[model samples]
Target: MTQVVFYILPQSLDNEPEDVSAHFIQACAIAAFYYGQSNKVFIFTDNQQDAFSVDEYLWQFDGDSFVPHNLLGEGPRYGTPVEISWQPPTHPRQILINLSSNVPKFAINFQQIIDFVPASETLKIAARTRYSTYKKMGLTLSTHAVTNDNAVESTKKAED
Candidate 1:
């Protein structure tokens, strides 16, 4: 069964017009965590702009640790260990970091899925639908209350 993890943020920046939201930043952090685990990851975005936003952020996410990634087709044929794209990945990834509004149908292919729930009322409402969908699939579902104070540590140190 696939494991689904929802990271609940302390604040809601889901409606931000720019890509500078905490939600997006946390996604990159989580992606880096998985990359450090030697797990191939696919970061699914809501649009082409979001895909680029993540690809750019990963470049400067951590000054010390680097997560080599590319935007889908622009990278090597099979791509790097981490890939960012608005469309489905051409190859299977061990983990799916979903930054999209609705879950992708191909979500079942991944061994694990990471999602975020901002502290906004609107996003919370939408989260319920996603929760139910995953539950119905009989997937192992869990949630983590994420605060800036403990965000980076739980993901494990990149240098470790």
Candidate 2:
């Protein structure tokens, strides 16, 4: 099994603590839906004192159709504490999706950081479209399509 892990970083114009949490949770839900469509098991890990709050919020979105395992830290120091100053709460939020032997077709296309942040309605739709595209390609939800050599060559030419 291969596990693809994505970490969500909060983006807020203001330093309001509440906004940070809200954005992080939204990103988590978006990521869960995308991964869930591939029939992958999704796990959420966070360091918030009220991780359950975020979990409950995500559970409210029914259309997502992804049941995620919530892993919360009791406090900043749970099992082992790392030394870092000014640790952003969002940095610790992560979504781990486990795939079978095959890699999903859309994995490479959607791996860009922008796909998982600020979860918006447009982004949700795009994610669904990508998921459906993979299904129609006769590829298993966990199967990744081999990259075309020509596409690689084109990219290399553009860089040069």
Candidate 3:
């Protein structure tokens, strides 16, 4: 069964548009660090710009730390631990970190799926819909409300 995790960000919906990318990058980096390079991760975005921005952010996410990643078509398909893509991944059962607005049809194929619920009412409503869809599918689900106070500690723990 797929494990779905919803991470609610500390930022309010008013600031969601501005800080969503940062939140997404931070969450992805932590997951990459925790899962390590052996486990492949796909960070899905809705557009080329978002994909490229995520690719760049992953590179500079941690000043002293790094996550091995590449844009979907930039390099060899298999070796890179993380892939930033606007399309579906070629591999099945990999970790999926979704930054898109809608639920992906291919989401059921992933071993794990992580998504964010921004503080914005509109985004949160969409996230709730996604959560309901996953629940209807009978997937194992979990939620973490991320706050500024615990964000650093959570990242640190994932690093370890």
State the lDDT of candidate 2 residue by residue for 1-160, as single tens digits. 2222222222332332353343444344444554544422222223333444445555554453644434333333331111111112223322223111123333332222212222346544544554455456543343221122321122223213
Q: Which of 1 and 3 is ahead in lDDT?
A: 1
TM-score of each: 0.90, 0.29, 0.84
Q: Give the per-residue lDDT of model 1 (tens digit) for 21-123.
A: 6677888888888888899999998999989888888887788889999999987999998999999999989999988888889999999998878778888
lDDT of 2: 0.33
Global lDDT of each candidate: 0.83, 0.33, 0.73
Flag the better candidate by lDDT, 2 or 3: 3
* Model 3 per-residue lDDT tens digits across residues 81-141: 7887889877653788888888888899998888888777788899999999989999998
- Lowest lDDT sum, 10 consecutive residues, model 3, at 12-21
lDDT of 1: 0.83
